[model samples]
Target: MSLHEQLYQWTASQGLDATSARRLRALSGVDDPPGDPWTPLRRGAGALAAGLIGFGLILWVAANWDDFGRAMRFGLLQAALAISLIAAAALRPWRAPLALAAFLTLGGLLAFFGQTYQTGADPWQLFALWAALGLPIAWASRSDLAWTPWALVVATGIGLWMETFGGHSWRFDASTVPVHAIGFVAYGLLCAGLALRPGAASQPWAWRLAVLASVIAISGTALGGLIARDVAPQFYLGLGVMGVGLVLAWRHSEVYAMSALALSVDTLLVVGLARWMSKERLDVGGYFLIALVACGLLAGSVTLILGRLRDAEARA
Candidate 1:
């Protein structure tokens, strides 16, 4: 536990008066050496600048596509990629932003290649390749500034692959196998994020993004099952995975994960109830009932999560 937390616990346990506790806190020097307030602003500015530069490069290429020959286009992208990578290696402080530039340039290069050659490959293939190639940059940067974007790229690739291979239908058929594949992929990402060392700069945001993607994927598949003629296996599997995730997150005192899982459960419950009501000739009373149940669930979930947070803070 942190020093401030220990001090608070000690004071509470000892039943110290307000003045005495204040004196003890002052003596502890926990409040000494105020940190730089500009750090967050600087980081945010750097990330924004990098994003703008990457996006501007893409737009410039697109706008001048007719003017530039094939060689010029490829040369421009390749040159940008090389320059970004070289600068990242040379400048330690600018590593994350430069790596991000390289990651974006790599994507642009692959996209131009596919367009130029007419590879006839699916869009997901391009994104997958981009993600695979960018993994090294993310690993080298060791920052969420890189990992978060990589995670997003991976999620987009998975979604596109699902759309291309799984089709739009949610029915329990051979084509829907890709839905289960996606669930497995989501679970894999969640597990990998959880396994990372928690003390790293990238850990918290990376894991949170993984959990978010997992929750969205599972919830979407499970909801689709509600519309299927026969229940899909993904429905049961997704619920089971969510149950396990909830238990693991609770054990680790991850309130964000718990809240996300609980919200998903609440959504499924409310939607399922509404579907059942529609089947039974639902009326105004039924609508009111659904609204009431939703409200209750929301309230209960909020209370439970807040209580858990309080308990965790007290323990800390």
Candidate 2:
């Protein structure tokens, strides 16, 4: 059908008045949306291919791990790292992907060497070394992908360090309360640095990962305190860190920062309610009333936050 006939039929089917129909036709007649969306898709596909190649190399090493002698294994890993680095340098615009591959391959080499030599070094030592070694590559690449892995490496090192000294597994407990508090505060500071530093404007992943890590640490410590019913001093430290983060987020007018702050606040409220419930004896009716109140509070809080977010978006 002709373009005008199609528009007429569409407007007639929708029962639109002449004025609205005219407006719609005028809007539709404007130039098509700008920019090449395929650019991102191509970049994403390239990164994915690089990641798959890296993972495939790891799998190959794993499959043939027992078959190779120590010298052979070391040679193979070193060769892989060298190849990836060379490819990264030669790949021009795809340098980020190959650089990331080389960075990850270095970790694999470290892990293999540690296993082969049976080093008595703590697990954190390996991760710390990995992060330290990767730092130069991340700086050279200046890619968010490189920064993401760097953040994860640092977080893993801190977590392993906490677990070893705090005498706790991955879970939070009285023994690990201080560790969680320290992690929460440290990561929150790191996030603030990432967000505010003059040199970090290009590294978007830094703030995102830092904020996520801080939230996890804060929520873990807070919830662990509620579960243990200890309410230790470290729990207060977490709260203090969260308060700082909240204020920073508000001052900066950042969406993710605000969301993370809201989440931590909600966690504190929920934990407090749980602790209070543990101390009280409630009949069925009383329990129902408490539940209703909690629900109402949650709903109201969510609505208010969402409205504020809308306002912020509009201003932006």
The prediction achieving the highest lDDT against the true structure is: 1
TM-score for each of the candidates: 0.84, 0.79
lDDT of 1: 0.79
Best by TM-score: 1
- lDDT tens digits by residue: candidate 1, 41-90: 77677788889998898889889989999899899999999999999999
Ten residues in a row with the worst lDDT in model 1? Answer: 194-203
Deviation from native of the Cα of residue 215 in model 1, angstroms:
1.4
lDDT to native, each model = 0.79, 0.75
The list of candidate 2 runs beyond 4 A from truth reads 1-35, 168-181, 196-203, 300-304, 307-316
Cα lDDT tens digits for candidate 2, 174-213? 5666666676656765666556654477557666887787
**Model 1: CA > 4 A from native:** 1-33, 168-182, 194-203, 229-231
